[model samples]
Target: MSAAITDGAVKALISQLGYSSLYPPQEMAVKSGILEYERILVTTPTASGKTLIAMMAILKAVEKGMKAVYLTPLRALASEKYDDLKILEKLDLGGSKIRVTVATTDYDSSGNELAGADVIVLTNEKMDTLFRHNAEWLGNVGIFVSDEVHLIGDRERGPTLEMMLTKIRRNYPQSQVVALSATVANSDEIADWLGCKLVESDWRPTKLVEGVYEYGAVKMSDGSKFKVESSGVSSAVDLAIDSFNGGGQALIFAETRKRAASLAAKAVDGVYKRLDKAARELAAGASADILARGDDSELTKTLAQLVAKGVAFHHKGIIKILTATPTLAAGVNLPARRVVIASILRYDSDYGGSVPISVLEYKQLCGRAGRPKYDAFGEAVIVSERGVNAEELYDHYVLGSPEPLRSQLSNDSAIRFHLLSAIATMPGMKKPEIHDLFAGTLFARQYRSATV
Candidate 1:
């Protein structure tokens, strides 16, 4: 059982919650001395107990009377982790209660408020804003856990995480940073940046079967093929129907909001036929709730109707529902027995045309397929369309490795903002200090020839 390997009090708490064994990656993480000051970068698949590694380190930090911070990429994920960590309040840390608090979009926490809590959860941006404002609580933390650490490669938001990490390592050098990330190709590079031990694994609790759907048949990566009863429907719709007929829920990811809604509406009839009376009533209630939001648009109505039949779609523009989207794939925990990639391309306004999504993004969507303990094996199928061939999709997505995590810290705008914030927040901070700080970033490590 995990209790024999985990900390005593932490073991008791986790055992009380029915968690007794450790996953392979989690066991490697705990054995790597993460709870004893060794920094660690965990790059593994989704639902692989990455968070448990963080929890073990956090409990260790709290046991030692040190504060810990849990940083997430999204507010929703922050809340989810906060709720999960709330159980730590019952952990008898030598008779002291562990104060767990969340600072997200809801309210900004003052230095004193954050300092008082044993564990503080925040979105990366929110945590960065707090640091910019010179929150005193940021300095006292001894453990900093970053979930979805692979986002450091994202251009728009990756810079903030990169800069925040640089600042954290510069300012709070003593803190133990446990970075949890999706499996990336260049995990060693990230570990080098954090100066941490690397733990990478392809182990998953549930088997994952990835493939491509074309001409009403799914060609699996393992060389197996299954005929789908799509009967004139797109491969995406056919896959969903096959999953439902097999008594499993399907999560379909579409590129556009309109396409997502249409697919959901199209899949509803197929999904409804397999639903029993109880499921039908539950789906109907959920659908009514979606419609009650009072958006009389046809898309909303279609979305609601689909939900009534036990199928739903998700996109940023549509109302938040239990469904599929790139955003959902990244931040939320809505799993399905099968995951369908409706499109591999999205309209990029910056490029003025549709562009193929990165391998990392597609992998995240595929990660949404297996629900641990519930599904024996999960299926992730990519639907091929015009201009995109089935063989190409299989090679590019089903068997491709995720892109490496590159720091976005060198952008002129990011440097300008962070430098200004550093000078303003740190008392008597000199130009030399700024130079030294930026020089220590992953950007500096990657581009040794360039001057920060």
Candidate 2:
């Protein structure tokens, strides 16, 4: 049966993905010339079906017979999104007709240029490495999706991402670029760089109620509020957890990795408080063997039960979420109903993680707040101590828009070294031809915002 439908281009895309309905943002994004293989930047809330928009654009490009690259910042997010897309592919009418591949940056999966695959899901670094090694194959690259384009504003990772965008354009000059961001202040400057179109909106499906908790009270823009205990700063976290009991996930922003871990461990006090005389007596007498192990597996099982009732943590020690690549959180499928971030915005480590967080890192953590498929609504929040103001965090970092995107030096030895190899292998192709590739990017979008 031919799956061709005349009146419903969107219906076709949604049908292909097994999605029943398209959110307004999703529909608006697709209607914005994604079929033209034009570069676009979509600024929407987390869990607002941004992935669907990216996949929709890629599907159109695939139908036109082209290659597309999907890039994300976290190994966890990359893997998670890749899994979601793969599931959608299984339902694709043209599923078997399209070739799709996924790999991390360190993995050497680009040996054949991914020429056989219509869509390649990988991290930003992996795609950069592929383009650096071979520009010839990328001539077929129609769309380059930069999932967290705001990362280009990151002081550390942003530098690399910035350079990678430059290198990609330097390689596939006409390729359409899709820059997706959740929290950026200056998205238009980035749109102007590649000259395409901009779809910028701060609209979130779930209403986020920002609140500030100090000393003993939790106050929101709305009148409903609560109180934190007076354990100095720890009391603030306790109150946030209490907020979760009523409704809304509390993403506590801690200051250090240790602080994050501390907050995670401490949030379980409610559980501990429940294990009083009767509960403790039952546990002590009910299952000594299960209790003897005293390991994470045991604790996780216990915590999982608590979570089933409605509670959990999102941080490093209890979950190894900070730096581990492939454990469980490698792609961020955190199930916590409330998130507590012990603000690591500024580093305090012996190895010196002393630099203030770049815009990318800030949003990355904040983005974890809302999980669309799971909740009626969720909250993305920030917490600060050391006399640091919550409003200040929101004004400068959390609530502020994303920073503008910029180009890093593309001819850096690593990038140039690889493109040179493709040049040697391609017979006749100048770097300028590659530079022309960016003609379809957000770098060139004229409809960008004037706010920043």
Candidate 3:
């Protein structure tokens, strides 16, 4: 209710939720002389009070009677965060006066309108393009929150985020920016872009241990090596099943639907293996077994019989298996005890075959470790077969510091599109200002390194 959040206010918010006091980074965030700040990037490990910090910023704006926009990279992420923010809204203000509205990028916003809300949640593509398309309404926005700010490193999607940030600042110079990101390699650079502060930390409630497992080659420190046990199911599926049996959840990352489905089928195989055979024979049990096992692939049928007893997989194709996954694996909190990567090589070339994953992609997938209540600690073990050289790819990139974030504006088309958006959003702003803002981006930092 106060213009500035007091320690008591902060304490009251945390106490009301029955959560412990804030983390050091969060405490610092709440008190950061934000009015003087234009853009702020909070870089912390997963589950490190990012949502709360984002809320504090939004609430501050709302208290001042200004509408704020929360942007995420994925539609599911937008929904998940929106739903969670709604709970806070109810707790703080009671009744759905509709303080928050979520606009999914892929879906229609027929039921709700973001144009008239205290807060709006949307994916980058939606709000970015929308503001560019309609510049008049940009004047009402007082705050903007960008979640997963580290995504600026993504060559494919980074332009949208960079353009959006530039668009807002150019459109409404007074609007405060709050960019939330996981622990990234270049937080300070991003902070400098928006002319805001950088709050960086490597703190996590849970510790993650990452390693490469060459099927039967390396032991898991206990001298017991994990065999790939290729179930004809993808390695990711196999790993998930192993985790569920060990009383843990897993998040498997797959780029393509086929890969996701194939990997999920493998996990479902393990689920099938665990079902009680006799229970599965009962009509309900049989149906459950059949559903879990999926098709009558002789091997699948046998796997289903095993599943009749208890096991299952998750991916796009296996509807039964998908139930076990986080549709939005990044921000979603369903932690898997063992998270696996199906394909590190994502893009295909007509002549060159497949392109290896960028460091950012690998980090995002690996960050799925230790999903909250599921495990005290999480394991991000890359699975490869014996004598297979794929392990080296991970060792050199994933297990190491990610390749530096790069600037996507290097592409003339990207620069031109951003230039158009900048003209629309921040009319009369000099071209030099656009370059500075874009250069302040993580993309520009990486681009500089590449050229150097």
Candidate 4:
């Protein structure tokens, strides 16, 4: 009900950004005292102003003459946050200017340089490495903003985030933590672990419609079926073509990099046929620019040709185009009118089998459907046939919530690495104290309960 922000510069910036009113999630976050140095975990839908909440807290920290650090899981995301936050550097913070720095890349920054920074953005690994090197400036940090906190569920990078958070919580007990997360099913558990209040919501700025595509028709989650004119073509191509014809961009998530490229190449004919002359020229120029970067390989050319036709596939392999890997989903800003999940199962060599991705992961993919300001509604389509069924996908992905956050600290290698780093960084930290630090981790909490 009340304006949670009281700082003059922050209020002016928010007004300049044209936020006359806060959305439900942002309002809850503010009312929860996130702006008052309370450790808070915000789990909400994308584009719901989580970044704004973090910024308000960061500004609050800077106003108190203390430094803040924004930690992201990916370098690209750190760069994106840096670009957005670097503008604050120009603001006269009551006669003194804020100095924002991005430390995502592998660079050696001295302690004095870091101490002079008002705000610093760094990736999880970069921050962990900084800790290993004992960045003395960390002692003066008053707040830490962690973006994409749900990545704690990831096996590879999850441990890094957990370790970093644990280290920050244990070592920097006086510093406040503002964690930003996607809407996960077990947000309360994560909140409990961090001793922060959970401000969760499913709010979205645009309406999202979920459906399953089969036989040239989409069976929406609401039980409404709409026939897509295939004109003898397959249903998948028809769905994509229809979206483009409706003047909206489409993003397709395939099972593999090869499938993504092949599907993009296949859709080119349909996409090109529907585009007008002006649109075609613009797509061609985009495609030419991609090719000019010059890999000349079949895959690159294949993707370039698709981009030329206003149809493109995204994955880790293809660069310069939109990507939707979990890492990219958090960082990349590409918005599509429709998102088609070509396959739910991705082959994981570690498991030596095809594994279905979690509903949370798929939900993140679906969240990409509508651009905030451009589209009235976004469509998320799941391609169903053969091995994967339509009804099952609808029940699992559409109806199901995200998976709970599980700690990755159980991995011996991860614990060993972090233990060594903690010991090396903390002066004269004894064995029993180190054990206490690990005992306070989410993994310890989960394991202790699982045994009970």
Best-performing candidate as measured by TM-score: 1
- Kindly give the number of clashing pairs for every candidate: 1, 43, 29, 0
lDDT of 1 by residue, 324-361 (tens): 55777765677788988888888887699989999998
TM values, all candidates: 0.91, 0.71, 0.77, 0.90
What does the lDDT come to for candidate 2? 0.56
Question: What tens digits encode model 4's per-residue C-alpha lDDT throughout 1-452?
Answer: 23666668777667756788778898898889887899999988777788888988898898898999999988778888998898787678778989999887664554455677899998898888888777888988999999988888888888889988988998899998999976567888888888888898888888889998877778887678887887564455667777877877777777766666666666767767777788778877777877888687987787677777677766322222232334456645566788777777877878999899898788888877887888888888988867677788888988887888888878888878877778877879987788787887888888983331
Give candidate 2 regions above 4 Å deviation: 1-12, 16-20, 92-95, 105-110, 229-233, 247-249, 272-339, 348-364, 373-377, 389-452
Q: What Cα-based lDDT does every candidate model obtain?
A: 0.80, 0.56, 0.63, 0.79
What digit string (tens of lDDT, one per residue) describes model 3 on residues 290-326? 7565675765564443333333333222222232332
Which regions in candidate 1 have their CA more than 4 angstroms from the true location? Answer: 2-6, 106-112, 231-233, 288-305, 315-322
lDDT pick, better of 3 and 4:
4
- Tell me the alpha-carbon RMSD of every candidate: 3.1, 7.3, 6.0, 3.2
Give residue 268's error in model 1 in angstroms: 2.1
Per-residue CA lDDT of model 2 for 87-193, tens digit only, reads 43553444346667776766445447566766778777676666555645577878888887766654345545765676666656778888787766666667766
Where's the lowest-lDDT run of ten residues in candidate 2? Answer: 320-329
Candidate 4: regions farther than 4 A off: 107-113, 231-237, 288-304, 315-326, 449-452
* Model with the higher lDDT, candidate 1 or 4: 1
